[model samples]
Target: MARVLIAPADTRLSNLRYGKSYNVLNNMTADDVTIDALVGEEETAVEAQNVHVRELGTQNRLQYYGRSFRTAAREIRAGSVDIYHHMNLSYRWFNPVLLAGIAADTPTVLGPCQTGHAIMAEEFNNMLSQAVGYELPLPVSNAVYYPMNAVRDVTIDPVRMSLFRRTLEAADRITVVHEEAREAYARHVDESKIDVIPLGVDAELFEFTERQDTQTLVAIGRLEQRKGYDVLLDALANVVEAFPNVHLDVFGEGPEEQALREQAASLGVADNVTFHGYVDQSVVRDHLARARAFVHPSRSESFSLVRLEAMAVGCPVVVTETAGAHEMVRDGKEGFVVPTEAAEPIADALLELLSDFELTRAMGARARERVERNYDWRAIGQQYVDLYRSLL
Candidate 1:
């Protein structure tokens, strides 16, 4: 049996960020594999049927994940484990500092991760401008925060790039969540060393349900700039003009909640939309199970697990080109893929779905079938097992 050390970014499965990582961690069970996983638990080790889990951190705080990687680098039983699999993201401040010192040295895997594609200055400004409308109050506008993030992004780039470059140098194999992420990393690492293994879904957990053909569109994501709740609201306003009874349900909450609510009211779609702040996954799955369509109008995103969940629940998705989730859909077959940050295109796609319920039902069935065939966690875990064997 080959021994493997898997370091997940988080194990609590509390927030949406770690959903994919947690699922992948639990499902990695093979007879020839002995899994040793570092979890988010401080004192208590959670039960996994096949994994021997331990804790290296008190909790999965924002700063803790980076610190956890730093901890993992410093402590490892050299040559005891066959492969060192850094199952979370690798591009961080101190993540690659001593990354190559793990068990078995050269046989290491990093990521199934992503460093989001660059956002141009012009694009950032335009997205914020659209999200923050004409009535710009000092407190209401998110414009001020953008400059801070821009400076942070600028300052962090060289450090992260240098660290990531070191990570590429040390990693024997690297995995990315999507093809775009693979392409982005290929500029720095050898393309042959990189693998595109997307985050998979459990079709059983998110079972297929027939769309009830209501004039309802659902979107699940944090109410933040990256998730593009602003663009969705703009499209909802237009969608309401055509189908006055159309409704939108948004899940998750963030710093942008107030700004988003104000934007919805400004667009005159407040009455048509409900902001359900930070609901459990079951609630999100329930909404996706019945909605006519799922629209994700993100300005910039590398991957979207929510889109996968929506698809698995038998709802077609209307995602923007910037989202990696668009790749999962065969345009017009599963759902329409629209341009990023454009309300008209999003609205147009929704209108088509609403116009023909039969199209949504067909698309929903296709979406579920595609997920079962291509994105099942059972099959995805097997891919990782294959990679581990290849390393050995």
Candidate 2:
């Protein structure tokens, strides 16, 4: 019976509501193998035997200390955990954990959720500066650029870069979620030690449902500039002239929500676009079941579960070529990918899908087939299990 320590970024393991990513670890546990999580304080009792919820004061941020890290490492060592998987960004506060894991001779695995090398390296610098008030050399290259209110300038911080590399150095292996991420890691690390395991979805949950024939399109993502809602709106301004019946449902909430709403009005397509802000996950599924197609125009993404979810439910997808969604969605076979931020091209792609019902159905069916064949959760979970075991 192998024991594994799964460390997540936040209080997700307890909240099944947004714990979709837990599929990899949660379902892979066996009767003999004990699964434990290092989670936040608010999490309720986890079903695993070795749950360690970090107790934080009113500040709500768990302060990491060498003593505490060593204590936890001692417990895991006593339990004889076969593997330690780091799922969180490489924060300097937890640097002691990396040291302790090494001291205890536990093989560590870093789960590169996106473009690991560039993103983690940048995040490493930030955590290091905040925790130590000094700059250090970054060892990895895990940088990700998406337009968010937090980092609007489109640059990864150097401090984050340092911390990310330190963490990468501690890991025995790294797992990338997509080909783009793998390529990004290859630029910094030995390609032999990095592996690609794309995110999987519950094919059953996103199974096909009866949908309306109305010329309605849906897009799901956080309401941020990187998501390209503004680009979609610009494209839609021309689309409505050709098909007045066309409508759009944008599903998400973020700092740019009001601005995007204003942009839609400015484009004179406000009436045609519906803002269904951040619906509950289940409700979002219900909404997806009713849409004719799913549209994603993000400038960048590691991989989009939204696309898999829509495809699992037999909805054809239209996305931009620049996103990681390009890797999973085949052009013209399961979905269509167009040029990024090119309003005319997007409008043309959308129109092409809307004008041909037979093509739409075929695309939707092919999308579902692709997901079932390659991205089911059980298959993905076993892959992680095998990866974990190889290091042991």
Candidate 3:
């Protein structure tokens, strides 16, 4: 068996979304270090080797996933682990300091966990290069903070870049959860070393549960411009005009909640759209089980675990073509994918499914089948294990 060390920017052992990366990695294999409790206690125990980081310094905070990498690396090295797997480094400040040691000795693979192809957009790529150098021109915007990019510069400073550059140049392999991201990373780094590995979810946790509810339309994810909740509300305005019983429920929280709420009221759909705010992961299944359908109108996404979760519960998903989830959903077969920016098409797609309950059920069944075969946690976990072993 190959021994691997998993390092996530977040407490992979406990985090609901990103933690899944670690869960898939360590489930049937050996994991050296899993910091910040990204996985729950029950999950950590199931894994063969589990280590936790208790420090809540400025580094390990929600925004500072990169800082934990060094601490994770230090511990992994101490234990003589074979491979270092870093999740979501491209998303935020992944300090170079921790990577320096790994690059120097062990074979390492950094998983680009966000939407894969999103980095290929010119605007996004330019912005990302700036972000890497700590000179991001765009203002920070994420959940729970005024300036989301505030820590970017500080975290990816000169000392950090030195470490990261060395690691990137020395790493034996570079991995992306999404295939598109692997291609994008190739443009910046060595293409020969890049590998595409799809991220996995615990399908059993979000398995389909038949429900009689028909009026509920659920949307879950960060409340940000990228998520296109505003467009969803605008589309809902048109949807409810023809179908009054349609009630849209939004899950998750972000910096754009107020703006989205105001848009909902402006569109005269406030009463029809309920913002669920940020809810516990345990209750997410309840919402998924009861919803009539799942709608994701994100303008951008590397990969959408929420969409995967919704589909796992047999909800017919209506997402935008611009989102990476489009790759996952087989249009007309599993779900629908429309233009990213327009509200008219979004509303049309929702109404189309609403008008035909039988069609929705058929598509939803297909959606569940797709995930069951390809995106389920155990199946996906084995793929990751194979990749880790191959590198060794």
Candidate 4:
């Protein structure tokens, strides 16, 4: 069996609910390949033989950039692994992992990395201007933002940019979660080197439950500005006037929680929205199983695993056209894909699904079938195995 070394930002598999590192590693072990992990530190007391943890002491920005690279480089050099798979490559981190791959003469796969969306900056600025009740002069705003965008494109950090280029040039293969992500990474490396391998969902964990009678709409994700919860709230305001009994259940928490609550109150939909902050996976699955539809208005996403999970539980989804997960759902077949940041379209989609029971049920069934055929973890893991063998 081929021994593959997996390097992730966190070694202990902490924060498994929010991230895919644990799921990808846990699922990758198969008959043809064995797995080992090289992590930053031992976050938990429970130990495992295949896992190696190191304390990099990344307390400050300098330490985070320097210490982490050196530690990971040392560990990667020591291991007698055939292939190196580094998860979550970012501007500032994972350079050492790439460097180690170079030193060991091993084939490296860097991946599912996603960059910031260009449209998001514009939409966020527009939203900020509306919230502050003033729009910046076009020339003034352009003058201020043009150079900043230029600099951001060229280099967010000089050292990090240098390392990012090196990693991109050194990688044997680069995998991305979506087409847009592949385009984003192409700006920095050869486009032919990038492949689209989406993140997966554990279908068994999110079994379907028949509940077409519910009027609840579900949204799962952290409360962030880019997530567009405020826009979802705006849509909810419109949705409630048509169906007063309709309720929205938001799961997850972040900086925008308080602001979203206030927005809900201001829109007079506070009573209809429930903020179920950071629930367990079981609770998420249970709500998804019962909810009439899942609505995610995120302005951008690399690949939305939550949407796939919702689909796995036989829940119809209404998401933005730009969302990477929208690729998995056929617009009008599984659910709707509306314009990003537009509340009316979102509200319309949600209302359509909520009002028609049979249509919603059929869509939910299609959603489940789509996930079963395309996003199962076992199938996704085999893709990795095939890629590894091809490289070998």
lDDT of each: 0.75, 0.69, 0.67, 0.75
Off by over 4 Å in 4: 9-12, 41-72, 75-79, 91-101, 117-162
Write candidate 2's Cα lDDT for 102-220 as tens digits. Answer: 53477777774575222333444444544553554444212322333258344445555555666666777878877877777666567788888777787776677644676989899
Q: How do the candidates rank by TM-score, highest first?
A: 1, 4, 2, 3
Model 4 poorest ten-residue lDDT run? 44-53
Worst 10 residues of 1 by lDDT: 132-141
Evaluate model 3: give its lDDT: 0.67
TM-score winner between 1 and 3, please give it: 1
Per residue, candidate 3 scores C-alpha lDDT tens digits across 1-392 of 34455555333244465466455544543353332332212333335344333433442233345455555656665866676666566543354544455446666767644533332222443345443545333343122132424564666456555555555556677666666666555655688887766666677777787645487899988776677888888899899989998998898886689988888888888899888888887677888788778899888776777788888889888998753555688888878888888999888888888888888888888988988887777766556566667777
Candidate 2, residue 173: Cα displacement in angstroms equals 1.7
Best by TM-score: 1
TM-score of every candidate: 0.84, 0.80, 0.76, 0.81
lDDT of 4 by residue, 1-392 (tens): 67666554443345357446655655554566666655544444223333344444432334344554554466557766677777677534345566545444877888767765544444545534543447755455556566766786566667666777888888889888877778778888899989888888888888987756889999998887788999999999999999999999999886689999999999999999999999898999899988999999988765678888888999999999764655788899988888987999999999899889999999999999998888887677668778888877
